[model samples]
Target: SELSEIHSALKEIEELESDNAGAEAPKNLAGAIKVQVDRVIRAYRTLLGMSGHAQEVLEVGENPDEEWKNVWLLLRRDLQKSMPRGSELEKAWHEAFNVDAEVAFEAALEVRDLAALMLVGVRYPFAPAALRATKASADLAFAEGQRALAAKGYSALMALEPFQSVSRQDLALAAIKGYLCTRELGWRKAEGEFKSWIDANPAAAVLWGEERKPIGALLLDFEKAIPSFDTLELQLGESLVSMPMATLAGQPSKAEPKNLETQAWPSLKIKGPLSPRTSYAMKNLLEVEVSPVIPTVTPTSILVNTGEALYGFDFLSGKSLWGDGVRLEAPRDAFHYSEQDPNLILTAARWQDLVIAPLENPLSKSTDAPKAKSSFGGSVFSHFPVVRRALVGVDQASGNILWTLGGQYRLRSDQASLPDLEKRIAVTSFFTLTVVDDVIYALGTTRENESQLHLVAIDPAQGKPMWSVLLGAGQGESNMFGNPMRDAMPGIPVVAEGVLYVQSNLGAVMAVEIASQRVLWVSRYEALPRPFTRIRSTAYRKVTHANGAPILTRDKKGNLLLIVAPTDSRFITAFDAESGEVRWRTQTENAQ
Candidate 1:
């Protein structure tokens, strides 16, 4: 009963903290909770000889990726043991922060007692002084043109690993600065890598480009501030693609676009009822009122969840893989299944978060431009639906919730009271879950100067974001699928040859360098629609969802082609996968 009560207390505390992110908790209340937790731990330890035990986190290793992952696990442990709990620095970490990168570095720099620290026998580990101070020293070296010392310092800092958003901020700074050091030394291959780190990792560059606070805003970059940059959309050539869809190298036209909603399967029959709400939004088919949103669908079975429940069947044999369906908090579009780890099911969702949808021409210079949404008739034209989801891993064999991401979720990056941390929702819900080499690549909508999609690669085991960046345009708005809900998201990111091919429903396709998280090129095939295109229902305007999924394949000569053949259009357009160059556009047999 004490353990159960402790769990309940933690949940209630999370809810209270969630209600007021920018405020301090009542001191008495916090003290009371801490006492209770201590009492519970003491009792459990005395009675049961242990409170609990988790699988030991993997140690930092030779693999850079693994080191990045295990960094936080060890960092949290070190910080707890190293820092005096009630110190001001520790308190600063408890609150949400947006401190300047230079300021933090300077604080570490101000610690002029290296001989004293040496007397304390501290090594280059995750301890605050070692991490922050060393990183600061390296940053100062870079700023002062001490390339050799900075390189060594950054290398040491990189090896230290980090835990929580704050230390991670330092780690990211160290990585980028290290890359700069490498570039300055004229190591060609390593220079590209350093530059790529700055591009792929938002924390390393765009988000931290300035020496400002909030430098540690990793996953909490829900409403990021953006400078007004051109969005850098690529242009498609006037040339036409001569190849037809059916004749494309690896794509079988008849076997493709085969869904229960779009096409009928004569041999397949619906055995029984599934979700209470059968229909969902599909970016490819804006013409249709609704479509299916399953995270994992294979030739043998389909796995779908709407925060209510989840299950799939071995269709060929009519065997239920997820028999009773695991109950969920809400329906979700993201799901991860790996052949390597077949027993684990990873799902992430966000519930009831705030989003300020950009109005039509809010920056329009002309006074006569439309200001309809935020003006007099704004209320009638708007609808606020419940937005909540969860980030969790389920046991595939038992249909059970195995682990959750936030709010007492052990693998958390930090113990801060983040508002939407537990919900784990994205800017755009994951349409398709992507797991490549044990890393999950997912999308979120960012509301900055322009509507742009954000990509974050996460480690499912820890629920920690490895890196993040802007994928392309058509973000933070309802324009993608023209849905009334107006939830922002980009196209499903399809990864091939270290390149992620994403088709934003608003007439654009972007190729992102997966390894670096950089947008190689973005080609806009159609014009972007005006804001509020859906509710206004303007007559005869073309919407971007008329497109199909990205088809990536290399010819015998080994040239990759990113092809798109819209259902409403007769011509099939092809872009050279390597360069985003328009190859050709030719008419198919069925011309509209």
Candidate 2:
């Protein structure tokens, strides 16, 4: 009987222990079940710690192998049972932990996942907050050379959260800075991000107006940020529209449209003291001839024409000398002036004939005044030997042309002609020519393509070609106008210090050696696909020497004052001439 009782007692004890374990579960218990779940999690963490591989193995998540799923389920159930109702901290903690677990699980499941982790975070509730912290931490780590840690942290955060307004702003800025520093994102991506930011933040529009970067790029952003219709309307009203005017019948007339026809009117009346009659009388009677002739002696007398029909006058006295029947028809483009010679006057006739005349001393008015001479047989410059051929030369004291050259060239019988050479050689209807040190340079496209640029140097003395350089061969494909047949043409080459500086419509500025015909250096404006297209046109002022280097200027807005000089490494630097440093740098949000 005593043995039987002992066995029954032992059986009852075993049953009670089993029931107690079952009751501890969340489904069975009403309160304090969290303690039991906490105990289990602590045990598992301890096991993880002991193994020294918990971080590595659990990188994907705490239960990466799905073996921890049951354990997690148990813990979660117990914690839910243990938590009090309506607890915000508990809710937040649950949400955060759940997201973290999901991220870990996904990471562990796919070792070769090519998808972005940050993109995954977009679907999670707590991702935004987590990502912010992670990004900040990663930034710090990157600075400290902890690359692996930083990367891991960034990936994890990206996987855990969606981007928020503040975070997106930060990312956009980072992207911009990265583009500036590494040029990795490229102009297109950088521009897109900048645009997105501006669109989202209209009140913060001033940030987009920073002129540190290329103006073309900034202009793109500005256009997107500001309403184009309103801006255009404002500009039109300010510049293109005219005010109403009173009619001869005493009724007011509506403002006339500003167009070619209106602008081309023979006479434009203004409401001022300078009326039609007074202006015409004054212009005819008191108009001092503005001469196109500019003459300079070795060091003394310099005579200039004031365009008046009177005889040539001394530049200092304005007194007419050697009055003659010769009168200029088109005062604007008919005459060529040379300040280097004071006594000689040169002019071209409507039919392409040139004449050289000498002026007498106005103070004397004696018959001994210098006699005028003429060289009027053929085109002076042989290349463009026919009518309208461009020419520049210095005349010898004798009645002969000293040195005359033309840009139009003809291929010899044995030499193959470039099919496009004529097109390339053909001068634009409107172009300018400049002569420096007896070498003549011409700027304009020849006939082959409208954008085709040819820079030809001619020997003014022999009417022979010295060198010719072409720019913008492949510019057509990249042009915005979709004209693939076009190319970047050369503007007038500015000569200084034996170096010929040339600007191209393709955004390249090149310096060439006059003697060797070699390219010394080249720099480009990198903001636009074709930055030159944005420029209405280019005009170069004379090069001024500063600090033993030549500084060049262009009329382009930001590039108005640019410096071009050689560096110690044989490289050329183009920066702001005023600052003597690169001025077009800006701080973007993204920097790497």
Score every model by TM-score. 0.38, 0.26
1-592 per-residue lDDT for model 1 (tens digits): 7567546654554454455446765545445444543453333333333433222233345843332233243344534543344543344333322233334434444684332222111222323545566655666666656565577566666555533234555666665567655643434465455445455665443335444533224313321221111111212244332212121111112111223222222232222223222112211122311222323433324344432345554523445666665544421442211111111122222111110011110111132111223445332223212122234566544555654432111224553354443323322233234554456666554333345456667676666666776665543333222223233334434555567776665556678887666889978664334332333332222222223346776564346798876433455778888889888778875555
Expressed as tens digits, the lDDT of each residue in 429-482 for candidate 2 is 112233444465554444432344555665544544556666435423321212
State the lDDT at 290 in candidate 2.
26
Candidate 2, residue 295: Cα displacement in angstroms equals: 11
For model 2, give the RMSD to the true fold. Answer: 25.5
RMSD of each: 27.8, 25.5
Where does candidate 1 stray beyond 4 Å?
1-290, 293-301, 304-309, 330-383, 386-392, 403-428, 446-450, 473-488, 527-548, 567-570, 588-592
What is the C-alpha local distance difference test score of each model? 0.43, 0.34
Segments of candidate 2 deviating more than 4 angstroms: 1-314, 318-389, 394-438, 441-444, 473-492, 504-506, 526-573, 576-592
Poorest 10 consecutive residues by lDDT, candidate 1: 354-363
